[model samples]
Target: MGVNISKGFLLVLVGLFAYLSLLLVLPFSQYVLGAILIAYVLYPLQQRLEERVAPPIAAFALVGLAVAGFVVPLVVIVAAIASDARRLLEQVNTDSIQLGELERAIEEQTGQTVDLPSALADAAQNVGTMVLESSTEWFSAITHTLIGLGLAIFLLYYLLKDGSDLLTWMRELTPLPDDVQDDFYQELDEVMWAVLAGHVMIAIIQGTLAGLGLLATGVPNAAFWTAIMIILSLIPLIGSFMVWGPAVIYLFLIEEPLLAVALFVYSMIVVGLSDDYLRPILVDRYAELNPAVIILGVLGGVYAFGVMGLFYGPVVLGALIAVLDVMNDHYDRLADEPGMR
Candidate 1:
């Protein structure tokens, strides 16, 4: 009875501390996960670099490379987005948005008048006002953003340098058999590649195609919008339509009916449907994940983890699938091994 009480007390302490620990790290969870994902992807290059240099040097060099390749481009794109956003706000506030054709069509068909320009102008005002009002919060977030970035870089450096050792330590801690662990690792690696290669490649293709339509329609800053489309395409349900859809409307508002129709058709048939056909061929080759899994992941992940959930959601599902696969195979073999029940 005394031993049972002692054990219960110890369990309570463990659970209490575990919950506290989680609370401590919860705010920075995304940054931590992002560093892990980036490290996983770059580990191969780190290995190659280590062939000619020390681990620390290799890691430092790769981190610099990552900063240049990933961080620099993102910073440039963000600045461009801000510039474009300001210009767009000015245009929206000043320009007479043409909706006469649509208004006439609506009145002719439905026998009702619609004040699209007034409604749009009101919406733009609300959006601009909200942004201005929230500027203080945005400024405050910069400090947090810098901290997260610094943490990610610091963690990434060590992850690259001692990642193998860390993995070995983790492997030792797990009670699973070697073969089962191996299977789990293999599945995870494949899923990582699937997310990076299959999903990202599709985004790039859709974005590029959408950009071509924008350029053909003579939209200003087509390249900037294209880059935005590429990023938006990473989200499953929304895809690249967020950008090109607006472009279609913009063309119509500018009274380019033929170009608007052409863009709408091209984006719908080409940019939109490309993933419907290509996903099975590409993602299946690597992860064999169902489309539904990814869809659910995106929905749930976004609700739970914000923007980073886009990457996390699919990976969580993939890990679950891997666990299930390993469990099934391992137990099936064990059951088949013959026994005195």
Candidate 2:
């Protein structure tokens, strides 16, 4: 009885500490967690390299390559997109002729005189003023982001270098029985594999199909839109729709009804089919999550944690389910044993 009480007290203390840490160290925790995730994704490659070379050297080389491979393309793509978006916004602001047709259409639809030219001028002025006022804030944000990136890289290096030792330490620290620890590790591995594989495959498929559709329909910024689709596809439900819906509406607004119809059909066939039909099959086969649970987990996670929440949210839910599953199995076995009842 005393031992049980002690264990309960320890559990409560641990929980309280965890809650406090989360509240106090959210920003630092985010960077560390992001680094850990990056390490998790790259660990397999690191392991393979270790088999071929010295472990230390292999880890260093693999982490370096992984960082470059992941970060460089991302930086380039984001910079390009930002440059293009700025240019687009600037062009839209400056080009007075572009608004003439839009104003006429609005006037025709509403049967009211719409002075769009004045509105556009006023908007441009407001944008300029806002940009000037916010320049310092933008620079500060960029500096913060750079600092976060550096911290993430440092965490990732240590994770790759000492991850095994850290796991061993965690195993020792966990209050659960040895059998439960093994089960927990196995379940966590399965969940990570399922999430990483399923989301990546779906993202690639959706991105490719969307890009192809846009290319076929002569949409501007096809690559940029496709990249956006890929990122958004990591979120469950309303994934492809967020990308294609606006494109369709824009095409229709631009008086390209036939092109809009083609885009809509193509998107339905490719994006809709893959998301509705293929994604569930792949995710279920690997993750073993209930469809309803996944939907709720994803939605709840997004609401709570934003983009990273999509990955971490489902992971937490799946981990809890795994723990419960192990407990249920153990209890059933105990019940079935002779004289236990």
Candidate 3:
């Protein structure tokens, strides 16, 4: 008994050390999980291609396609924006573009002196403080972001190439009944598809459409505002309005009443309705998670994991609910047992 107690104590000690060791690399955990998700999403295409070609080649092709289809356009857009950014930065002192025209227009309409600069003095000071504070950290952030992206892609390639084997190995390590393991994974598969394909994809579509509408309607700084909308769209009930709401008001303030009305109508009809009608069909049809659960999860996930929390939050919450439902079914079956009674 003493020997057994000593062994158990050693095991606990080793487990504690292992947990502490994982904390050291906790920063990379998000990158690793992101890679896993990317691989899972693209696995179907890889499987189809693998039938005709090798798995490695199939993964390579898919990765290339992903880079070209998504990353390439983003890189092009950034490159185009960079030149404009450089010119803008160079002329920042001379231009005073932030509210120069808007302020002048407001002053003209009201026939009142608008000390917009003075009003924004606090904001400018905050910005200055932020720049001063983060000036040193920006390089570190950029480096981590770049490294995270590269690692995600690299890990994605391997996951896609050996996913089946990895799943098999994991199953072997699991102590649960084989059928129980299967059920868990099957439910996980459905939940992941619903979260990634239905909710997340639809949100992106809504954001893109909204951005196009903004651009077509001639909203200034459309790209910048569109990015904000995409991030806001992650919240189930509250979406893109946080960005475009101000834009609509700006148009009215600037005497572009017609443009303001058009933007407001577009936002109400297109951006507004898409989140309400489309997201549920995608999520509820499979995930069975109500908007309330999702909203709570989004709020909690953001609080816990930050930005990636958008995807992580919904997926984790949906998976939990799915697992619980499966457990209920298993319990229902067990209720028939005389011993259970």
User: What's each prediction's TM-score?
Assistant: 0.76, 0.75, 0.78
**TM-score of candidate 1 on Cα atoms, chains taken together:** 0.76
- The candidate with the higher lDDT, 1 or 2, is 1
Q: With candidate 2 superimposed using the best TM-score fit, by how many Å does residue 7's alpha carbon deviate from the native? A: 10
Question: Candidate 3, residues 1-341: lDDT per residue as tens digits?
Answer: 99999999999999999999889657877787777777888998988998999999999988877667778768865764676577677776956565878878988899887778787898899999999999779988889989988888888899989987998899887755666677888898888887776667877877777787778777765666677778777777677888778888888998989988998899889877876687666766565557776688788988877776788888788888877877776766545552331
Which 10 successive residues of model 2 have the least lDDT summed? 332-341
Model 3 earns a TM-score of 0.78
**Regions of model 1 farther than 4 Å from truth:** 1-16, 85-139, 220-228, 265-270, 273-284, 332-341
* Candidate rank order under lDDT: 1, 3, 2
**Which predicted model would earn the best lDDT?**
1
Return the clash pairs for model 2, or none: none
In model 3, residue pairs whose N, Cα or C atoms come closer than 3 Å (at least 3 residues apart or on different chains), thus clashing, are: none
83-168 per-residue lDDT for model 1 (tens digits): 76788788774346447877998899999889988988999999999999999999889988899889999999999999989999
Estimate, for each residue in 164-239, the C-alpha lDDT of model 2 and write its tens digit: 7888899777756667678778888788767666765677788779877887887777768888888777666657
